[model samples]
Target: MENKIAFIRQHGIRVRIHALLVDRYLQTYYDKLGWFSDPYEVFRDIVNDPDKHYIFKSILAKTNVSKFDLPNKEAYQDFFGVNPVSSFKQLSSHCSWTGGCLLEKLERAISYDLPGLLSSVSKAAATPAPAKAAPSPPPPLPGTCEGPGCEEKPKNRWRKQ
Candidate 1:
């Protein structure tokens, strides 16, 4: 899976530098906050961050980044005979590409304490909801005669009375 993700990182229009940086930062942050044992686990938690939001925006816009980031794009090209290099080059050269912006923010955000945010989020998520009290047992039926001196009675009848 890492290999596949790495391949996507290489060819996808959305540069992964920012996502990777954020992921690394969030992990350390989560760990320091006592939310996670290591920095690696922040991938699942920080996936909803701005990096992913940028990817979603690209996908919604049907931009070059979205086209390039399709899962198994290489296989798709092999089956369809479409070249990816031309599109990749165009996207790389685009003046206002979101990928470029994402990369820039990732660089800027690197110095900031992103882990603190992630740690707070992780702590909130880790907190379990309060358990509901168990239901009370039902009361005994009236006139059941459960005392020690009472004789056992047959269902719906009294014996030889």
Candidate 2:
């Protein structure tokens, strides 16, 4: 964990809101900012995308995304990949905001049936952990031998005059 933290820090990554799940669309929300190298790049793509103009908008509209609450690159792809230039609400009639937990919510949002972007995450989670073995006893310390047959330092006898 320390190494991972150090690596992230050394690489100039920041934990930003990657995506806002269920904020507008059921499949719309994401982890809401994660460790990102250039978080604004994500924001720029979304706000600038000609397709995303309706879900996101000018000062006159209520937007589903924010600078801090933006989706990762995958969600953007999937959103557009599924249906570009069309509202996500038309995707389905399911309206359960609180169906799954955070992880499940993320899985649902990103883990597509096809080998899409988040397939790695689902694959990892599905993989079973290796079994653990029992720990062995510690070794004995030095200079503390007291059993029989164990040698002790030689003792000198008194010299005769």
Candidate 3:
């Protein structure tokens, strides 16, 4: 019974780490696109894309679970009832939960249990804030008429010839 409890705890930690890594990977991927209006929509699009999905699966397969104190893929699959690919996708689906996103949970876990991972992710995603671009010159200052065809005319005044 003690061994079973230990195994469960170990498995939970591994699952949490795996979820963290997946969230980091997805955030980096979406960040490269400049802007994503809705993170959930982008996530769904990425998950639906066969090529992208395969790449994500490959990342999971290549990542060293042992470093996170988890068993190898085959063993994990045998014990968890699902392969790493399926497990990753399932966890990622929970990232959009209303209570608290999986990434937020992962962040808290890392902050408490694995500060190094949290620091690494923060450094990796720390992009310089894009320059402000001069606030776009504040439009045209009402209706001053600056365009090519914009002619200056008196207010409500008509020409009589």
Candidate 4:
């Protein structure tokens, strides 16, 4: 649990820094409004703008896909090999306001399948482990080792030490 928290903290810092760098680059090249925009600006915009908020949520849903969708692990690897955010941004550029109908399709698909997907995941996770078989009885104690009045040595006598 501590390891997971530490990882999340480190990952969050990297994401924050990357977002800052991207914001700085865009402002320098596109906006030229230095100090006026920062990493928090986009976040603030997402909070303030209802449409942008939903767009961001839709993109998040798209990346967290169903595990069953891919045939092989390689296919899963290839699917996530490309950055979904970059793809969404590029695809969304086709429409300035809401990216034409892509956002709608994405939201619709998630809404349609998320419940069943979540339910299946929950069911699989909740399934109990198989019961183990009872252990075989121990061999009759040495010396008392049974074989119709046999005379096997005691176990302690067999120890090399």
Candidate 5:
């Protein structure tokens, strides 16, 4: 259990770092092209084409990084051994690509203090709802008597004899 927790933390850190690196790389390329509309889509287009894959691979290689270095790469391989890159490839296949889905997958791969979130959620769920204060008795109506079993009476207006 402890080992799993440690791996999760490490995975989160690596994924975050990788995200920053990918964003920086994409931004730089986008800047060079004078294109600024949507960088992730550009990145997706680059990744999806075999011709462009070389450029993408060059960019990655220049950074001295590998897909294998990414967190959960093994899990990706284990789960989708036939096409480990398919997970990333799908990012481009979609009509609208934001890179958010990729980030989410990475986030989920790592626990990201999930235990803390769960504990806080559990504490909130376990807490009693302050008993609702019993809805307090309604305020007495005007001209009403102020004793138990009392009812409203008309105000006396005549002068006392």
Candidate 6:
């Protein structure tokens, strides 16, 4: 709100905006906010803010980020697509459901205090995780010899002959 008034005051750009037409005025500034008129960019920006993490964090933890780090709008659309990013309200009367919520509150970020959330989400945004090492064989049985060059005898066969 302050930004809109400041920009208007600074540049001397005239707008016939009023209580009802504010949405129209806001739409003009959408590109400047960095969506690049592309939903993929919007998704990218919203996911990284940590505040908006709730909107997509579950998907991040469960799936490879690469599955979503699409290169363009077409690819993003073809992937697990979403509802219109445009219609997502900055403040909604009914926010607890999908495709509706408080944009500012959502993007303001509450995960900074959570190491698991920060590490998983932010690091994944930056790069893929390193591969894990294979597990070592289980410790030898109680009666079996342990350590290098030690081999256990075979159990009795053929009813001890």
Q: List the residue pairs that clash in candidate 6.
A: 51-109
Give the per-residue lDDT digits (tens) of candidate 4, residues 14-91.
443333333332333333235676644544343334243343333235454333332332332243344332332323
Per-candidate clash tally:
0, 9, 0, 0, 0, 1
**TM-scores of all predicted structures:** 0.24, 0.20, 0.29, 0.23, 0.29, 0.21
lDDT of each: 0.42, 0.42, 0.51, 0.43, 0.50, 0.40
Ranking by TM-score: 3, 5, 1, 4, 6, 2
Rate residue 81 of model 1 by lDDT.
36
Question: What is the Cα-based TM-score of model 5?
Answer: 0.29
The ten-residue window of minimal lDDT in model 2 covers 13-22
Off by over 4 Å in 4: 1-20, 33-126, 140-161
Write one digit per residue (lDDT tens) for candidate 1, span 18-38.
Answer: 243333333334444454454
| Tens digit of per-residue lDDT, candidate 6, span 57-102 | 4333543333233233243333324545455433334467666554
Task: State in Å the error of residue 33, model 5.
Answer: 2.5
Among these predictions, the greatest lDDT belongs to 3
Superior by lDDT: candidate 5 or candidate 6: 5
**Candidate 2: regions farther than 4 A off:** 1-48, 51-54, 57-66, 72-79, 82-92, 96-161
Off by over 4 Å in 1: 1-80, 90-92, 95-100, 105-121, 130-132, 137-161
TM-score for predicted model 2 compared with the true structure: 0.20
